[model samples]
Target: MTAAVVTGLGVTAPNGLGTEEFWKATLAGESGLGPVTRFDAAQYPSRIAGEVTGYAAEEHIPSRLMPQTDHMTRLALTAADWALADAGIDTGELPEYGIGVVTSASGGAVEFGQRELQNLWSKGKEYVSAYQSFAWFYAVNTGQISIRHKLRGPSGVLLTEQAGGIDAIGHARRHIRKGFPAVIAGGVDAAICPWGWVPQIASGLMSTVDDPARAYLPFAAEASGYVPGEGGAILLLEDAESAAGRGAEHIYGEIAGYAAT
Candidate 1:
């Protein structure tokens, strides 16, 4: 029996911008939690969040495209580029039917949402950048990733709350098994800012602790609910035959098998 292989990995998490950074922080048991920066906390009940700090869009995003791409989409695209490069696939002319993208994400263009609302209330409709038309949409990450890579093959997004993280891996593995050759697979959730919390604030699933340590603690004795977070990751998935033929390193593991309810 053949196994699906991992050829590339990219991650943007509350810990850091890429897999290296994420790994360093994780190994040291670093806490990424903090007060939200995109807005003032004078009014919101939940002021603290797990914010990804020191990440500059310019460092990860191409200057020309940044003006048009939303923050969430930018993270996804940047991660995708790194993943594809790590896979050693020149996406400039990808195999027509072998490349695909399967990603999971929650709220997108959320920062955009928070800002656009301000524009509407303080400025005018024309003041809204056209990117607002779809920046925060769930499908934007998958769409932008596919477009950047010219995947031209089957592409999809998983919106199953936090379940999306593993769902994306399953999607890519299934696609590879079906003989798709290669697929970019992962999940991203970049909704930790202002508007990201509106629904949660209303739904009462958010934290109320002013101390970052006490806020959004999961699985602890003082466990509250989750903190809204924003970040992205992409892992390159390929058929076993392809990766063994090329010989890549840092192969984390395989898409062995996953279980769900």
Candidate 2:
């Protein structure tokens, strides 16, 4: 069996924007949970959440893509770019068919869907963008990343909620074992808008406490429910032998074993 190793990481987390920043804050016991500012949540039962602060999409994404993509897709694209750069991958030098992408999503792009629906009802059906046809799909992240980087190898998207990220990585490893040299495998999710909140609230698993510190205490005596958050991570997964041949730096770890029920 070919060993799959992680060569790079890109993180857009509530606590930090990059891997180094996130790790430092986590070690110091810092918290990113706070009152929701994406929208007016005063009337909602859950008023607080972990939002990715200080992120300006304009800085990371091209202006042309702004109109077509949602908040989550933008973040995913930026994360994928960062991961590829971190891995020192020069797509121009490698065979495009030898690289692949596999990611996971939970709720798709509710923010974009909500906006399109508003336009449809307020104006007319013609006002809705054709991009809306695929923007809200759960596989949009994987498709967008693949298109952006021109990775023409085996690609796929998994939708197993929290376990989806791991499943995607496992699938990527399978592809690598099948002879692909490199793969981008991870997950990114952002559904912190009104339409997205509706489903989370309906699930009855969201924390109602407004206090950030007191909320989202899982497996504790004071545990209520959990706080919802936006942002996730992307990672570069490469075959171990191929990584060594290319003089790849920063081998974080290996996917020693994976099994799913």
Candidate 3:
């Protein structure tokens, strides 16, 4: 039987830019939750969030592609790049059609959508860019990542909210079982903008507590709600046999089993 194993991991989280930083913070029980800064959250019920900081998009992405991509897409792209590097599998040496991308995105690109809408209303339709059409779509990450990497295999996007990331990996495992060499699967989300906040606020699930430490107590009875966060993770899923053949190091545990109803 074929098997899928995690060879590399890349992360862009509110706490850290890459896996190393994120792991250190996580191990120390440090919280990334803080007062929102991307925009003024003064009026919102939930004024705090786990926003990614110190990320320089230009450092990870080419300037030509920057303007066309939204923040979430940038996170996804960067994470994927890091994941590929960590795996030691160079795309330049791989078969294009053998590599695949499967990702999950819940909010799409709220900031981009919001800005485009504002342009449409204030500056007329002519002000909007052509990329606006798909920049904010939920499936944009998978499409963009696939194109950037020249991956022509079984690519797809999952939309199961928080569960989507895990679902993406499961799907990739199935794809590998069916004969694809490998798949990049993960999730990225950056929906803290005005438009995004409004919908989240409407859900009534966000924490309104002003105190960052006491704001999100999910396990306690005093748990009012949870703080919102933005970021994503990317993982390289290669079959066990192929990974061993290529001398890939499995630092993380292999996917022993997967099931979804």
Candidate 4:
């Protein structure tokens, strides 16, 4: 049997971008819930969201792939980049075939899909980007991360709605146990746009409260529903032996066990 340990963590949350910053905020009991600014939520029933602030994709994403990816993909890419740095695994020095990527996405790329549809109707089919067909898929993150970092092990994507992120980590552990040196696994999503929100609203699981502070209350008597938000997390899972062989220090934690129904 092989041991799978978590060596790196990357996050893009409504409260923070990096691990340390996010930790501090969490410790302080900070709340990221506020008015939705990504678009006008005034006309919608739910007008608040836990949105990531101060995120500039151009600073984190490669310029070449900027126009080709949606905000969800860019967030995943940024998280992956930071996760690699956190693990001290330089992609250039690692064996191309030793690493892999696995991610989960519930919403796919609603923002990109919405834009493409608008383009087709407002302008023409030619005005729509060729990247939309692939970029809007749920598996785009896994594919993009694998290509950008040259990881060639076993790559895949999981779509289990809210539980998908946790499931991805479990699958990555399975990959490591099966002989892969390491795996990048996690989930991301951004469906706060009009079209995206409509479908989510139809689910009837979202809150319609006008006050951001009192909107999302889980397991509480005041619990109405959830406030939609954008952002996700990424983690680097490596074999314990491989991590020790490379003298990789600063391990955060370990996924000692995992299972799914």
What are the lDDT scores of the predictions, listed in order? Answer: 0.79, 0.90, 0.90, 0.89
The estimated TM-scores of all candidates read 0.91, 0.97, 0.97, 0.97
Report clash pairs, candidate 2.
none
TM-score of 1: 0.91
Clashing pairs in 4: none
> Which residue ranges in model 3 land beyond 4 Å of their true spot?
none
Q: Write the per-residue lDDT of candidate 1 for residues 1-261, one digit (tens) a residue.
A: 557888898887778877888889889988788888866866888887766677788987768778667777887887887887777766554468778888888766777777887898899888888877777688888888887667887799888887897889888888888877788988877776657777878888788888877776677888776777777678998888877765655566788987677
> What C-alpha lDDT, on a 0 to 100 scale, does residue 229 get in candidate 1?
73
Cα RMSD, model 3: 1.1
Better of 2 and 3 by lDDT: 2
User: What is the overall TM-score of model 3 with all chains considered together?
Assistant: 0.97
Candidate with the greatest lDDT versus the true structure: 2
Candidate 2 matches the true fold with a TM-score of 0.97
Tell me the lDDT of model 2 at 8.
Answer: 83
Mark the 10 consecutive residues where model 3 has the least summed lDDT.
249-258
lDDT digits (tens) for residues 1-261 of candidate 2: 899999989988899998888889899998899999998998889888899999999999999888889999998998899889999978767786989999999989999999999999999999999999999898999999999889998999999988888898999999989989999988888888899898899999989988899998898998989888888889999999989988887899999889999
Off by over 4 Å in 4: none
